[model samples]
Target: MNVFVSEVRQLIDRHLPHYVQSLQAEPRLKEAMCYSLEAGGKRVRPLLLMAVLEAYGKPISIGLEAACAIEMVHTYSLIHDDLPAMDDDDYRRGQLTNHKMYDEATAILAGDALLTHSFGLIADAETTEMTAEIKVALISIFSKAIGAPGMVGGQLADMLAEKKSLTVDELAHIHRRKTGDLLTFSIVAGAYIAGVNKEDRLCLEQFGQELGLVFQIKDDILDVESDSETLGKPVGSDETNYKSTYPGLLGLDGAKKMLSYHHEQAKGYLHKLGLSDTILGEIADYLVERLH
Candidate 1:
């Protein structure tokens, strides 16, 4: 798993920035895009996509474009999430957020550029295996995953729920779309590229749902348990923002249990698909147990 992660990280680092630099856009805009994308994230979303390909015995090259596209979208979300109107954070991944490195307006535009370009990457991807039909299918589901019916809508719901009371179920509802939708896309996209049957794809989506819960719950736990040096961002930001979190709504111990429950549930779905011994399962454990 470590080798797999390192390889994917290297691939993204090698290609994503150069792709942006090759663009015929304003230089500053290009720089801003590269700046955020260069941050050394765990690359969880992209890894999930590629892992699905590996599980089906497909080469990573076949899904590299889609993997990179999802990373672009994920980076854009983080950039926007740290803006003044949002989380208002100054640091991310132990460095300055886009707004702090450049400015608010530039940060906003950088995010937009990444988001818009992501679809184009998938739609007109150079992947030899990606037919026009496959490209459209990828784009349709990709758009829906991050658009209004997914991440965007979830963001709005999160904003609305802030400072107000929320139950565990409500919090789950918001995050399922906000965080889970993109994850579901990652898994489903891989299955699509692998040409898996619909039955298997549905099982992966179920696993993605449970994994999403684990991701959010662990994030909530880290917000309380981790510090600035370790997390690369300020701790206690959830409480500072008065946003409902798993740890905040349920006690820390309760959140840990929820995290474990979902972690195990996620593995169960993989078991159903007989992927428990594969990289897919390993990544699930990584996401659940990751400290930062």
Candidate 2:
């Protein structure tokens, strides 16, 4: 856990409760929903969104709702991904997964609610000081990133690929959609809100996609090497399902080398942007170093 991620987790903890509490539905069900939201996962995407905003000399407060919206989408994906029809996991973030803690139907509803509610959160964001065009751009970017051509399509490909052999390029494509798309939005949303020019925003998009590919490779490596207790989910599940992964296709040593290559590429982009912020560097380092 890096210090910056720790700080971001604290920010989420402080802000998310008020937002959830205000949702005010069936108190028990809503409480369960909040439980899943506040269960202390790594708030990685949200932190990246905020950090990118900060890197552009913008206040994090300007993107707080957007940041939290990203988390909501991430959380919803995890909950559904853990469903019996999906990954069928029993644990997450060192706790019972939503389906295991609550019932499957409740978990389904929770995920659905989170996804829809995320849009509402973004819509209700206090952008009074921002121009209308910037706000509209933020909304468009977030929607497209999480919609049909992005995360949803990626998830479908991932499901279809289970127990199947895929070329390195195919695997990369699936990962880009499944994981990279939302991450791209994370960077783009921040930059769009901060009025970054189109060319600069494109650079950030490239950075996000490259960084996302590295992140997924590292995640696959962790699935091979990390313990179930440490991972809070079944380890070696990729092997169990006969799925292709970096380690499966490239071998552990080869995968490590490939990860190094992606990391260098991403670092090169960040350097071109003249970023001195150690947070972005640390994120890159964390993505590569966490597999062990």
Q: Which candidate achieves the best TM-score against the true structure?
A: 1
Clash tally, candidates in order: 0, 0
Q: Report the lDDT tens digits of candidate 1 across residue range 1-292.
A: 9999899889878989987988999999999999999988788888998999888898988888888899999999989988999878898988999999999999999999999999988886776679898899889999999999999899889988989989999999999999999988999999888888999999998998898889889999999999878898789988888888888888999999999999999999999999989998999998877889
lDDT of each: 0.90, 0.83
Error of 1 at 265 (Å): 1.2
List candidate 1 stretches off by more than 4 Å. none
Off by over 4 Å in 2: 1-3, 128-130, 276-278
Candidate 2 lDDT at 146 equals 81
Query: How well does each candidate superpose onto the true structure, as a TM-score?
Result: 0.97, 0.94
lDDT per residue as tens, model 2, 7-111: 777888787767778886877667767878898777778878878876877777888888888888888888998899988888887788998998998999888
Question: How many Å off is the CA of 40 in candidate 1?
Answer: 1.4
After TM-score superposition, the amount by which residue 142's alpha carbon in candidate 2 deviates from its true location, in angstroms, is: 1.7
